[model samples]
Target: MKYRFVIILLSILILSSCEFSQKRYKPDWDKWKNYKWILNKNVRNNINSGFTLYKKNANFNLIRYNENNQLVIWEFKHHNYVSIDSINFFENIDLSNFILYPGQTFNKEDILETSVRINSDLDIDLHLNLNSDSKIYEYINKDKVKGIIGKVSQMSLSDETGYHQVLFDFPIRSYNVATLFFKRDDSFFILILFPDDGLVKDKLKDLNLPELNE
Candidate 1:
């Protein structure tokens, strides 16, 4: 009987340690890879679908369910030697339930507001959001270039295509974008981008609209 008690205690300790070492953020990258493509038929059903040219300095392509929906932007560089990064934003949503890292939490609503404010304050010409099936998608394109700004003379940088484009640059901004969202049963999935890339940002944005802000 004493030996049985010792074995049970050892088992409990092993399980506890294993649980502690496990990763809290479960990742699912493939969920949205295929979803990123926009079928030509999607554009036909949504007439708001089209790419916009902004003063030859930037390009934006989008599809919308309505005019008031929040915009989603995806931008990147196309140079052979240069690579771009992506960011994803949400409007009027409670994103705290979604885990990004161990003991990390963020509000989806705040992210959207910040992006809106930054682009608007910079006079970067914020695009319109189109809503459908409850989701809104927006795509943005910019000159592949880099610059500097802010009070400390903070260095600003971007690719020739105007996107930060790397995953490493985002930790400072407090984002660990996991584009894979589990399906209804946590089996299949959906891809969500904090900052989307131009290659598929527009394509994904052209997908079915998500539910609206309540």
Candidate 2:
């Protein structure tokens, strides 16, 4: 009977150790610092989908719900290369040019109808503008380009609710220049569009975001 009790206690210790190790392996964002919240009328009007931008080191990150209604995040790094130029470039561009047909898969030709380029050397210009390292230039240059169709979906976060026009993919270079427009009541906003580069996959796992309802 004593040997049976000892075996059960050993099993309990093994399970507890496994659980502790799993928890320890998880990434913790709360420990990270230097993230600052910033407001940009342009971002508010165009790309953020009415959400605020978070600047971390030199990278800019935004979080929002995608067409699938899943929480997705977009990140733009190496900002010193593109920030001002991107802002000025997008200011003159009209978003009305790009509209997605519902229930259809969009292509590069469909995107061209809206005046946004799938790939532009102008993006490469950001790297040149900053006189970035060759490796950095190559990284941006080699990033694959893809299109994200713009569509509006109603979403609520905390107490605020609005209809957000989801658009484009990121690294900012891929979409050339795109925008996300949001309307909440009588107010309208725009943000400079970038491609959805999926840089937030691991970060999202770290955040432990709750499963959202459709």
Candidate 3:
């Protein structure tokens, strides 16, 4: 009886520790506002998705252009890195070698490399998933060899600078997507590009952006 009681207490303690650790690593969104934003001209022109990327150390601030040509800003803080090689078809090729062509037909393998990283650890992914269908799973099936296929209507690329940026139009009806591939770091940073619809556009009205005079 004493041993059972002791075991229960130990289990509770372990659970508590895990909970605390998760909370500790949870991103502090409030503090993210304080990071300085430096304009990245290379990203602005090369991948002309109407969004400009600003660097803040390992983090980035994205200024997205809505359908109306208005700008909305979003900040992305890197939480953790997931290797692209872990995904099936991507295992043999480096992500940088892949070029995205707009209006091109791509199978599950093409989107998998980017979608997995987006879905794996970000709250933004959850928000998108709730609003749209499970497009990610739509591509996966019994034959790991044969995957789902879809078309990419909007896409952009930039390789001039050291960092490679590729923007893939999200399968979701209303969202845009941009991903940064860093050669030196061997990692990718995903940025959610909120569509310039009335719902999201109104909320970003108060965001202070850098001067466009330059």
Query: In order, what lDDT does every prediction score?
Result: 0.27, 0.26, 0.30
Q: Determine which window of 10 residues in candidate 2 has minimal summed lDDT.
A: 128-137
Instruction: List residue ranges in candidate 2 displaced over 4 A.
Output: 1-28, 31-36, 39-60, 64-79, 86-122, 126-214
**What is the full ranking by TM-score, best candidate first?**
3, 1, 2
Candidate 3: give the clashing pairs. Answer: none
Candidate 1 segments whose C-alpha is farther than 4 A from its true place: 1-8, 17-29, 34-170, 174-193, 196-207, 210-214
Off by over 4 Å in 3: 2-7, 10-16, 19-24, 27-30, 33-173, 179-188, 197-214
Range of the 10 consecutive residues with the lowest summed lDDT in candidate 3? 124-133
Q: lDDT: which candidate is best?
A: 3
Give candidate 1's root-mean-square deviation (CA, Å).
18.9
Q: Which is the winner by lDDT between candidate 1 and candidate 3?
A: 3
